[model samples]
Target: MILLVVGADRVDAGKTTFSTGLLERTGAVGYKPRAGNDFWFDHDDCRRALADGRLYGKDAARLSAAASRGRAPERLNPVHRLWQPSPDGGSGLLGRSDREFVVDRIGRDPEDALFVRNATAEVPDAVADALPLADAVSIETVAEFNDLTEREYVPAFDRLADEIEDTDVAVVESYSDIARPLSSLDPAQVAAVAAVEPGRVRIYSGDRYCRACEIASSSPRDGAIEKRVPDVLDYLDPLERVRLPPLDKEQRDDPARIARAYANAYDAFLDAAGRV
Candidate 1:
């Protein structure tokens, strides 16, 4: 499953951690269009791929795809930097185009990948665009711009969930840590997460973690298919091939660590896929 993880502009909301959890839980491919956390696809990967491969488009896509599997250029790290606006002090993420670039090499490469501007809803759209078109995509919806929202993140999340329902999903994040089943979280996210890790501990909502110790026994979407259901399933879940997302031990940022975690698990998924 080529899932897109969307992070709102909050640091500790656990979007990356939740993505890591999803990757770990399902053992999916863990593809990174552009590195946000520790899992980086720096310029070197692009350069190396560009140098070694005849097809720049295919190879560049492959390089981004491979970062999650532990083999990528060194420059991939520091894919993005933290930048906040002056005076207002609002959050702004360093993009691939940032002057003091970290993932500058990507820009040097010919691929169309963009250094994400911020980890907001905008990031997901960019991620969706960069991917080489996958069967399904999973998006992690969280608060944007640190709105100090209680359930206010729901609208953005709901829009996201509505947009991607027909695409793909493995384990989607929900703010229902207490298992309240609030409408803020789409039923599909609840269904997807609940179905995948039935009766296991899952991050329900950004607010708290929910121990999914109780299986619904029936499908969360039991009654009928909702409107425009994406008709896609995470092919990687049943896949035993495990991709072990490489971890950068020196780094402390949860996003980076989660990226590596996803990469490691993705490598595991590849291993599992080999048997097929």
Candidate 2:
């Protein structure tokens, strides 16, 4: 399966929309390897679950709805980070110094538990065994909070890497820009995108300010292809690229109309990918 890294030069550059379009058009699954942001749920039940700490992410929920086939939403986003404050005054999402919450979640899988146990001897068996049976775990650890450590990140990275390896046409969405000196897209993440075989990883840039373009331009291109995504207003034909009038604000805001735009963009992307 090809690995398509859907990313933008800046935040809210329509990465998710583009990915959603691809999933809708191609039947490809979505995997958010590393997500660090707020969870927003439009459904009242999801909001309540999040308030109660039972559910953690909004992006995962939507991705699950759009893709996941029959798998759980949590599987798509195994490790996540948010800005919730911990009890200790430290800013990690998960409260407490011992981080039993993180340990427990990762340790739920017997093999993953072993990996966690090996990462730090401080983890107790009860915590390891207490892995919630739920499909996903909401991790509140963030680097900004200074709550994340190498031990925790290692397991999360392992999970991320494992998923990418196992997935077919993994649409990896980048977090932030890597070219900006202080970008969210780490060098390691860029390396992961680069690791895909040449011509297998399709890097598409969105809009004029896209950071993904910088990444694509700066990163080594042994065989990987980089193409500009068609503007949302375009009526893209898989056989030919066509331009259409831009959508008015009302039409753009309509979910149904935006979905159609994504479909067109996906056609263009797939067409470009085919030629490569």
Candidate 3:
């Protein structure tokens, strides 16, 4: 069964924190299909991962650690993108004014494939040198990037889904506010869906939630057209709403502590999912 955890806020909705606790309580495996970090803001994390000849955001790392049988961060998160801010009022290949794409790490292998954007020449020398450029696919435009994702990332996600089938429950976390991370995932496969904010979580029926996503997207189910949380929520009523207490830094990091503190909320989620 799949328990999807999605963010209501665009950023910092505590999806990872909530998912960690759920995994601890249920002994479920974790999966973060896609994730990213900014080069300017998440410098330390970027540098550390680069030092190990890889790239992965902290969320994926934490999810891997919280799982019943811990997996490699790359295997847990199949697609990770690196971004940098454009301070000089310039745009990258994707045409975003504030930030530009640097590179993308796709698939799960000892030597994962890298998609280095042509705009990387504009990045700082130290950061560029540290990137895994050897045997990397060079991308020049948004269309090319989209093509690459269709060709490569889709298959990687498929493989990851196949791997998850062996586990009893898989906690699937969506990126940002995206309703569903994997387009291929059937609604019937999901046990429950949770939309989380700062101090509360709203539970919805899995099939209804996926149908809402389809309505919100209003496009073909290619996983390319993503709908935000509010857009999907417009079509359905929640099964339950549970309040969450604030956690101290130590408590937030400890999965067992989080599970204990959030026992009520977890119970509500399981009950809504029909697991109880």
Candidate 4:
């Protein structure tokens, strides 16, 4: 199984959307891999989190038959950190935390839990323990840096490298928007990361992508789509089924745009299924 780690220049480059897109492409559910109870969910949590509940009702139904594929979402996304929306917002363990929640407790296969993480250098130790070691791995690169400072991110990678220890090769998602002088990131260091895993693929959004997203925040023109998505859209062609940035926040709020993007992502899913 391949562990795909998605990233972007910063927050809105559509990591979640891209992860959703990849799941669609992979016939895998678009799960956060880190749904938690003071911890991320286990495979059973994903399965039990069926159509009966909120957003995942349909998903729970779809995944019901599958055995944790091989790992739990928590195992996939061992550690995470999210800032409270407002400074006063509560912040603690981001997702499900332990094997108990993932094992028979949540009620699914622990092995099949492959996770999708919006990783940074600063993930927690326990969370790192839970993540699956990739036979193959893919990392999405950022085009720009959001608020993360060189101070925080520089040491993060040291921690990240500690996780896998060593592997064959790790695919690096390349980017053009990141400015230099990032103490934490050294583009030159990509080769070293790749040294761990030599089999790699670099997915570019397009020969052309928006250098500047017109929407300050991704919002949709459609009423039902998500405000987090972009208005300009098109379905991904099968051969070009790689995930890209998601629609802006505004797009997530728009119903029509949300449907369109979801449909577009689904198209990629259909195409990918045909191959494997």
Q: In candidate 1, what residue range of length 10 has the lowest lDDT sum?
A: 222-231
lDDT of each: 0.30, 0.40, 0.82, 0.28
The C-alpha local distance difference test score for the whole of candidate 2 amounts to: 0.40
Model 1 segments beyond 4 Å from truth? 1-9, 31-276
Candidate 2 lDDT over 7-31, as tens digits, reads: 3244444444445545666676676
Tens-place lDDT digits, model 1, residues 1-276? 223233222233333343554454454433222222211234343343435421122222333333355633222221222122233333223221222211111222334322322223232233334433242222222232123222223343344334434444333322212222223333323322221121111111221111222321222321111211111221112223233333343332343455455554444433433322
Tens digits of per-residue lDDT, candidate 4, 2-34, equal 223233232324333333333333444222222
Order of models, best TM-score first: 3, 2, 4, 1
The segments of candidate 4 whose C-alpha lies over 4 angstroms from its true place after superposition are 1-9, 20-70, 85-202, 205-276
If candidate 3 were superposed on the true structure by all CA atoms, what would the RMSD be? 2.5
Show model 3 residue runs off by greater than 4 Å: 217-223
Model 2 deviation from the true structure expressed as Cα RMSD, one decimal place: 11.3
Residue 187 shift from truth in candidate 1, angstroms: 9.0
Every candidate's CA RMSD: 15.1, 11.3, 2.5, 15.5
Residue-level lDDT of model 3, residues 67-152, one tens digit each, is 84747788889889888887766655766678777777887663746555554436556566866665678877668868877788
